[model samples]
Target: MATLLLTGASGLVGSRLLPRLVEAGHTVRALVRGDVTLPAGAAAVHGDLADPGSLRPAVKDVEAVVHLAALFRTTDEDAVWRANLDGTRNLLSAVQAYAPRARFVMTSTGNVYDADATRPARESDPCSPTQAYPASKVAAEALVRESGLTWSVLRLPFVYGEGDGHLASMPGLVSRFGLHPAHTYSVAHHRDVAQVVKMALAGTLDSRVVNVTDDAPITVLEMTALAGSEVEGSAEPLTDPWHGRMDGTLLRELGFSPEVPTVQAAARAGIL
Candidate 1:
């Protein structure tokens, strides 16, 4: 087992992933800004990504870094940039200076893909995100790629399950984004997110940007219904059917088979 430094331990994704990393027999040091409770096996190391001075101590001697910290779903665009791009620059600099050999695994979003793609977005597709969140992620991804560290980037889709309430928010998001009911989206369960992170730490996904998603791309109509809500059905022609869909062939080629293969499967298993 390796000594790992995990950022964003109190957030939705990190909160779920931290205990899993510890349960897998790894030593985990969770980096946080203020007083916060962590999973039993993790040691808390107070630090903020915005403060470069606080990062060195947290990263020192770590064998790997799982960077799950990012800002999204906020109206403040500047805050989004600072937290996502500038903060990642700080972490990358600290790791390079303090723990030069640590493997860096950064989680990103599938929204970075362009909306008018002909098919499910691939790793090589050009990222042209117009919104602040995904734009910042694209810039941050550039930093990680150019940081000269052993790095792996996981582009996550609509993460759900484990009562995170992310799936339940689909109805609101559908109305907000003006999405057609027939439009499909790729998704990942929290369990599968941890599974892929373990694989990255094992060096199975070095020097690659991988799309981590489940086996099925679910429709917005089904997602809304599953969320215990309803949306108006649309028979109108969909303009961007593949907008949020991603190609998971790369992950499969890398020997990844999602534990929760589909949202329907998740519902059946009582995990959603």
Candidate 2:
């Protein structure tokens, strides 16, 4: 098993990924900005992606890196840019200095794809993100691409699972953002996300950009229902039909079939 280093150990996906890595018999070193309780069989290293000097200790001697850290919910665009873009550059620099040979797996978002796409966004799609979060992620992706390290960027769709608050907050977000009830989002489970991370580390996936999602896209109305809420009004005409729709064909072809294939299935599995 490989000795791996991971960032965002305290995050939702990272918290779940740690246990899976340990169960796979890998020696896991998790990086956090402060003290954090690590999953069993994993060691925690104090480090911050924004602080390049602190990242050295975390990257040393590790065989691979799965970077999951980012600021997602902040309204402050500058803070988001620094954490996502600058932090990624800092981490890549450390990787180049200490673990250049390590497979660097970056967890990106599907929102980085062009929001005005006429069809489901693919890996080859051009990016022109309007939001700060996805904009920062797109910038971060560029850094990873030019870093000269063995790398893979996983563009994940909206991920949900047990204890995930995203779905629960869907109602408020829909109204707040003026999203139509018909607005669709490609969704995935946390389990599937962890599975892909394992595959990325195993080198089963080729180094490049890959989109990860469940079998199909779900409407906002459907998602709201899953969250135990109702969409009160008819959907307005959408300007960007492909805002959240993503093609998961590539990930499925790569032998990653989700156990929870849809939002309906997720609800049945008690993950909604």
Best by TM-score: 1
Scored by CA lDDT, what does every candidate get? Answer: 0.95, 0.87
Candidate 1's residue-wise lDDT over 1-272, tens digit each? 99999998888899999999999999999998888888788999989999999998899999999999999888999999999999999999999999999999999999999999999999999998999999999999999999999999999999999999988998999888787999999999999999999999999999999999999999999999999997989899999778999999999999999999999999999999
Task: Evaluate residue 3 in candidate 1 and report its C-alpha lDDT on the 0 to 100 scale.
Answer: 98
**lDDT tens digits, residues 117-170, model 2?**
899999998898888999999999989988888888999898888777878888
Q: After superposition, how far is residue 135 of candidate 1 from its true place, in Å?
A: 1.3
Best by lDDT: 1
TM-score of each: 0.98, 0.95
